[model samples]
Target: MLHLVTGHAGFIGFHTACRLLERGDGVIGLDNLNDYYDPALKQARLAALQALATRTGGFYRDVRANLADAAAVDAVFAQHRIERVINLAAQAGVRYSLQNPRAYVESNISGFVNLLEACRHHGVGHLSYASTSSVYGASTALPYSEHVAADHPLQFYAATKRANELMAHAYSHLYRLPTTGLRFFTVYGPWGRPDMAPFLFTRAILEGRPIQLFNHGRHSRDFTYVGDIVEGVLRASDRPAAPDPAWTSAAPDPARSNAPWRVYNLGASAPVALVDFIDALEAAIGKPAIRELAPLQPGDVPDTAADTTGLQADVGYAPATPLREGVQRFVDWYRGFYKV
Candidate 1:
């Protein structure tokens, strides 16, 4: 199969692309390579993809373009025989969204619409896109379920992600497009986002700096490992969404629709305390972290736990990586990559 992977130079995208290539699929990667964290890291990921492609004899081509550009997206569809699409490109930080809401609007909203248009026009079979656990905003519910209503988004980032789900549903309903949105929970592992907690904590601990514990170490998260995330994504992509036969408009479930659209949580289903996660990192690095407990930042959720039962039932998805092992793998990669 030929796969079109947006944000291919990104953390998850890079891993996903490599997995696809390894499975003997031709992949075309698209990314603007914006300096959201470090352009060097993005470049390194791209280089690694190229090397792997050369070694495996699997075609891997990357196009430098923004998803917001309709012409660019259309051109790619027109040029390649793209069978499936994995849309991972977006302005990705919750705090960053608070600072610049426009970026979220441009990339997450406008860019997603462009991708939908291209998919509808082209003969794309399955369109799998990244949604966020942030969409479960302001809901005090533990073990957030896909059937629950997510109308109250606390941050602009969550709002945009919710908007994407709505937009994809519309496309699926109108065009019979097979679209699946995966609501990813606190994803972390090697090559993780630099802005995320795992990377920040690892860097601070290695450099002998204090690690800030938000909400004074009271927060909890379902930290899904990146490898598990990539595996779930691939499984979901292979299984194109189908309209639920039991779906009824009178009592509609938010997770499934009468159209060929669905949403599932990709998470570990086990929420770990912030301090415990930090301790795992410290153990991985063999160094104790200088603690700096601080007040919770705005647009941040105090806790998140994923109800992945639906994902498991549908795709047999199960996250198998233990937190300690995942943290150790990340620490090893960080040390090797940064020479710390």
Candidate 2:
């Protein structure tokens, strides 16, 4: 399979691309490699991908460009015979969305439309994109299910992702495009984002710095490991969405469509409390964090858990990596990578 994986240098994207390459699939990676966090980390991930491609004898092309650039996106499609698209690109931070709403609009909304247009014109067989469990905002639902109405987004970041879902549905309905939206819960593992809790907590603990605990460390998250996520992504992408036979317009299901569109929540289906997760990190790293408990920041949720049954039923998605083991792996990677 030949895939166009946007944001291929990102944490999940890097891992996803690597898995596809290892399986002998051609991957065309598109990433602007912006300095949203650290460009060096993105570069390192790109370097790793290049090395993997060389070692595995898989076709891999790194294209440095932003999705917001329509000409650039169209040019890529014009150049490559892309069959599938895995969109992992977006301005990802919730708090950052609050501070710079324009960035979200540009990257998440405008850039997404560009890709959608390209897919529609290029006759792409399947399009799988990253959504978020945060789309279950304002709904104090314990297990975030795809069938539930996710119209209310608490933050700009989530709103943009929800907009992507709606946009995909429109394209799917109008053009008969096959689209799958994977709503990810809190994801953590090796090469995870530095801005996320696991990386932040690990780095702070290693440096003996204070680690901020939001919502007074009371929130729980269904933290899925990267390997499991990549597996789910590939499986769902391999099975392009089709018009749900059980779908009805009279009473629509938010997760399925009369069109070739489907949405599923991807996670471990097990939520761990923030403090307990911290304890796991401490155990993995052999260090204690200088904890600084604080109120939940704006645009942040108190708790998040995923109802992963939708993906399970559709694509046999089962995320079984235990939290402790995943944390240990991440800690080991962090220490080795940073020479800590």
Candidate 3:
């Protein structure tokens, strides 16, 4: 089977693409390689994919274009029989959204609509896009479930992702397009984003710099491993969503629709506290961290947990990597990748 994986050089995207290629599936990787964190890291990931594809004799093609460019997006669809799509491309980063909301609209909102249109027209079987746990903003509920209404989003990034889910639902209803929105909880593992806490804390500890503990070291996150996430993505992509026959407008479920649309939380379902997470990192890196406490930043949540019951039911699995084990693997890769 051939697949189009947007943002294939991204942390999760890189892993997902590698897995697909490893399994002997043809892959078309599309990435803008923006300087979101560091294009160097993305480039390294791209080079790695190139080498792996060559070594494994797996079909691989890389396309460099922004999804916001409708012409570029259409050209891709016109060129290839992209059977499945994994939409991981987005202007990610919660804090940055405050400074530049337009970037979010251009990429997250517009780019997504472009993909939806292409999928609707091209008869793509399934499109699984990235969503986030931040959509459950201002809700004190523990282990956020997809069934509940996520009407309050604290940041523009979350709002855009929520919009993607809603927009996908419309296409599913009208055109019978199959779509899945994965609401990932604090994913941390090898090739993780530098802006996230795992990378920041790991870098700071190794460099003897102080790592700031947001929410005064009390924040907890369901830090799912990248490998586990990739597994879940593949499973979901292989299974097209079906209309929930029991769904009704009068008593609607936000996660399931009468259309061929569904949303599931892809997480470990095990939240680790910040202090404990740092401790695990220190142990893995064999170095002590200089700790600093800081107040919670805007658009930041004190805690986040995922209700992965729906994910397990649909995909037949959930994230299961242990925190210490995953952190160790990340540190090992960091040392090798950066020679630190």
Who wins the lDDT comparison?
1
Off by over 4 Å in 3: none
Better of 1 and 2 by lDDT: 1
- Residue 229 error for model 1, in Å? 0.4
In model 3, the Cα lDDT at residue 149 comes to 97
TM-score per prediction, in order, is: 0.99, 0.99, 0.99
lDDT of 1 by residue, 169-232 (tens): 9999999999999999999998888999899988888889998888999999999899999999
lDDT of each: 0.95, 0.94, 0.93
Worst 10 residues of 2 by lDDT: 139-148
Off by over 4 Å in 2: none
Q: What lDDT tens digits, residue by residue, belong to model 2 across residues 1-340?
A: 8999999999999999999999989999999999899989999999999999999999999999999999999999999999999999999988889889999999999999999999999999999999999999888978888888998899999999999999999999999999999998899999999988899889899999999998998999998999999999999999999998889989999999999999999999999999999999999999888999999888888988989888898889898799999999999999999999
Report residue 326 deviation for candidate 3 (angstroms): 0.2
Q: What clash pairs does model 2 have?
A: none
